[model samples]
Target: MGDTGMPRAFIPRPSPCAPPSPISVFATIDSPPWTLAMSTYGYENCVAGTFYGFTKTEFNPGDTFSLQWGAIDDGATPLNITLGRAGGYIIDEIIVGAQFTKTSALYQLVVDDTANCTLEEFSWAIPDDFNTTDPQYQIGLFNASVLLGADGVPLFGWQAWNPDFYVRPVSSTTTTDASSTTSTVAATATGGNTTTTTSATSLSTFSASPTSSSVSDDSTSNSETIGIGVGVGVGVAALAAVLLGAFYLRRRRKKAQTPSQGLGGVRQQYIQELPATEKRPPMHELAG
Candidate 1:
């Protein structure tokens, strides 16, 4: 028998390992695919590090994955970056590293798909009123949409500790008068005696050498005396005529009655002709 470990026929074919040509190994490691994007703004000159316990591939709640700086204004002054809750970590707080002035700030949210080996990133801006003490600023693993709340739902409840100052509204009134020469006068009168008077004097000449003078006085007094006089002119002829007419009428009546008295017989005849009830009608007849 030939030696057990020895080759029977030494057939040396061309050596396959004769200095293999340089083969470049191209790496095709597929990176995780991005599913969602989240971002924030307003942070400038912030240090780059693992914030909110989020690694380069992890996300946390309330995470500002990416960051951008905004201008200095009454709104959020500093931009913040942190892990988003989409991945699993509940963000309980936010840490702002630097202040920002002028320029928009931006941030992004990123997540890693462990099963599919995919990475997701979403972008967003820090809100205008974003502040550490702002009520809207919340932490913990909560849905962004849910945290923002719906139409009827309440938003965050954190109150800003810093007080904001504002100017108070002012009101004014104005009054104007049209006439310049108009005057207002107020007077009070008291006690027993008070007098008010107005006076005016004037002179006029209708012809040469004409002269005129006048005086007027109005007075009030406690006691006053007034005198009145009447003058009568007597006429002897008028008086005598009235007396003579009176005397004539008396004489005529006397003469007429004398005849009547002397003629008693005629009188008696006239009287006998008269009726006893002639002077008055009977009571029943008078009533009718």
Candidate 2:
């Protein structure tokens, strides 16, 4: 199997930690298939960038089959490989010297340990006629993770792109049409808090734009309230100081003024008046 390009036939092995549980995420058609050629890999109608290789393009009901590949970073850095809902095993980037040996980090998914090479199969069997009413009718693989930064900003891992293979009626629908949903999670870290969101929506030319004006408005309102509170406190303090100064000046002026007494009331004579009855007459007579 290593020499040839084909994978060897073997029983599906269980994961060491835990088997990937089948999730309800469905496959979506990002762009029209015309943009992506049958022979070449194109980024035409894809929402998130991915490299895919599957055994068959079309399948039927009750068919036992599998889609296998590795999760490569089309954009996000530190590319991580998760089993996801596709129920695949983790493997190391292989490098084999053979005519048809697939030796790419982003190509075929395989095991790192040669001793445990047999545990590298991502297999799934198709169910009978699927219920038409159910929106999630197709099965797919997803590479998803949320990265939190110290600034409360969120970075994403491999984006939730469409899977390699989708199970659907061949004639009824030529292209896969999967519905996408967004889930928001509140995440708190040691330094700051962040809001993590996982969305499967395709990145189209006319993708929906979110409104951040509400958050801005709330922040603005809070700032205004704080400013008003501070202004009011300062004004009140200034007014109290002015009132206290005015009262103190009035009390000092009242104390400085001398009190006067009526004729019947006894008052302290600061200066005693001597007998001045003959003084003016004697001066006038002597001058004459």
Best by lDDT: 2
Give me candidate 2's TM-score against the actual structure.
0.24
Regions of candidate 1 where Cα sits further than 4 Å from its true position: 1-116, 134-288
The best candidate in terms of TM-score: 2
Error of 2 at 57 (Å): 23
Worst 10 residues of 2 by lDDT: 92-101
Per-residue error for 276 in candidate 2, Å, reads 11
Q: RMSD (Cα, Å) of candidate 1? A: 35.8
Error of 2 at 162 (Å): 31
Encode model 2's per-residue lDDT on 240-279: one tens digit a residue.
9999999999998877663443432433342344444554
